[model samples]
Target: MTPGGRASTAAPAEATATTITFFGGKGGVGKTTMAAASAIGLADAGWRTLVVSTDPAHSLGDAFGTELTDRPRELSENLWAAEPDAEAAVRRRVAQVTEDARSTLPREVMPAVQRHLAHAAATPGMAESALADLLMDAMERVPGEWDLLVVDSAPTGHLLRLINLPELLGPWVEGLVRQRERVASADSLVAGMVGSQERDSADDDPLLARLRERRGKLERAAERLRAEACVRLVLLPRRMVLAETERAADQLSEAGFRLGPVVLNQIPERPDPRVVEAVWRRFEPQGVLELPLAAEEPVGIERLRPLAR
Candidate 1:
């Protein structure tokens, strides 16, 4: 709605490449299912699309019935999909960083820092940063190449972190990368543990420079994407799911994020009077996954084809 930005829809509108939407919410809310269908639909309607799953437990591969990897794999003709490996990505990031540090830092301090990263990677927020790096890479290398970049996100904690994280941590990571370079040069601006001239002169500065530059690029990826990104949430009709949605909306608002459409997945489909009592009976227990209800399955392009129209 800004000069050339995407407009929010009160109802579904024509699809355009400028819009990048995310399907997210509670674990069992059919996010991956909906996301896959939507991407397939967009592709069928003539837009080139990519669907990336940020979840540690990825299922986009299963949803598409095709083998996938960190790299984009073609599904049919126009749809491309990937499931970013959060843990493996973290290890790759560390490998690149430590390899650069091996020649820069004093032999004693470098090993200690490497060990610290090993333990830190086992924690929660560490993996998210690595995923953020992937997000940055995607946006820069292929901007304007795809009509849509849809994400099949993880559960609440990860979904919240995925979009808002880069902006919050970008400066801190940049500062740390800068500090490492300064120490390696023996300037020891903050950590005066070495002689001024004896700093690790053999260290690589470009690697740290690239990391810092990458962080800056990531800091803007979300907002830049937001010019078209809509954080659409899917939810069950149950009280717990709806209540959780409210809390998520509030928290994301605090981080400058807004929720788009709330997809009511697993709702009942056309019913007959003969099965009236039976339908409610089935849904009452299953809550959202009953057979009589509209089972949110991937329909390839038949269902999603209209989303772009």
Candidate 2:
């Protein structure tokens, strides 16, 4: 055990395909530090690792002592890091939707569609949805480009919403597809009755096709998260942090997410053993990896590597 307590030396689990490990907790709990360190450890262990920060307020770049963009940048021989631009992602999604609407809807309806899209772009959770879409793209690159993908997610509430997004939106998209199918069916019947030669099939309708494709993507994303991803919450040993962590763990468990070992960060020297024991007992069955308080902030690859080990 290290001076802090017991430090877990085991690297992240090896996978035949790309496996994702997300480090998340309440704000200011050092989630980014743990995630960066874990990615570095994976890279040192011969796994090609990519660490991405999904938090709108990203500190992953700061942790690496370098700036990062939406695209991945190499930090070491086998490690890369990125802080995705949430605003840009939201704009891209809005533009895509606008283009799709233009192609499928009547010109008279375009104004209304554009207005709705504009409002949606500013609504709550829009950024999270956009970020989730970008994450899905990264997940698709998987074993071919990276052996492991470590995510430094937003604070607990936002992270939980992002995790459950696909499920929440999937059914809504499916309903839209069904509604479109019904409208198409009615149109086709009218065309048949009127002896019109220009009858459109539901399968060939651009709008319905787009909706189906979107629904399929949401389903696949959700499945990959449940099957190939694990969440490791990072928290301090304080009472409030511990209570929040417990609630977050329960929320994750209820959502059918796989929980990895919880990281107990910044354990003080000569701490009360009872507090540590209480944390252990509270998070029983799930291993607790302890990290001692560092003399200085663990920034840069060299400084972070020790914690990784």
Candidate 3:
């Protein structure tokens, strides 16, 4: 698909099939600019679109010359943009998980539980998990408030982790649910032996309920990502960038995501045809969409339009 052109219709249809397109690459690859330009193109085509930045160091706002928050801000007709605060997202997730534990666990153990949770909040993958949850929320808004969602993700590594969260965490949540079920079963058995009738059913157990809810959400997110989302890696013509993009494409494909066209941004005026040919050869069956280096920086919607074209 060329910038704002209709996304590939090859994806599996859902009851509300809102397409999610992601743009990602190494730092300085102009993915943010590409993402903003793409969103503008979609809006011009009459698709109600919301473009979001999941990168910690957000530049989507700069691209549009507007300040943005986690809430969507209208950029133009049919186009909205937002940059989610990664730190706030992580804190909110920690608070929610802590609240859930507080409601389920005994008061005597609450302090230790909180401590453990605090440590987990500081763990390496916590931020990515929170960001993935935020992305899932955006996905759930499809065809209701917007017809399309565009994500300007972080650098390659973080974006990969964010995209892989559903696949990785779904099974972990399922295991928690099973463990809770076993504990509830044992509790029921003990209560029966003692002739006590205060045991709660598995469905009514707070922890089990929470785990099941999380598992269901993750499962839905995974299905949408694997079946309805397309990831397009934006890259420059440099050798290092090309290498990273190649690896990213392979990883995304192996993770069951549909790889869209690789976007080659900022092509020089006297570009080497050989390098372009090499890129096409490397990514056969996946189109290579090129954007020429702008005479001036494409800062706002009007300047970005020609690049989108």
lDDT of each: 0.65, 0.82, 0.81
Best candidate, TM-score-wise?
Answer: 2
- Residues 186-247 of candidate 3 have per-residue lDDT tens digits of 88899999999857756567777877777778778777778788888888877777887889
The order by descending lDDT is 2, 3, 1
TM-score of each: 0.73, 0.88, 0.88
> Model 2, range 104-178, lDDT digits (tens) per residue?
678999999989999999976788788878888888876557767899965556656656766787788878988
Q: What is the lDDT of residue 101 in candidate 3?
A: 81
Query: CA lDDT of 301 in candidate 3?
Result: 88
Q: Least lDDT summed over 10 consecutive residues: which range in candidate 2?
A: 1-10
- The residue ranges of model 2 lying beyond 4 angstroms of the native Cα positions read 1-18, 188-204
Total clashes for model 2: 0
- Residues 1-309 of candidate 1 have per-residue lDDT tens digits of 111123445324543435666777888777887888778766676666788887778888877666789988887766889987778889998887787777556688986988987888887767877877776666554435665678887455654565665766777776777676655555544334543444342244656666677666766776665565666666665666666866775666565554565565665554343433432343343232222234355444454443323
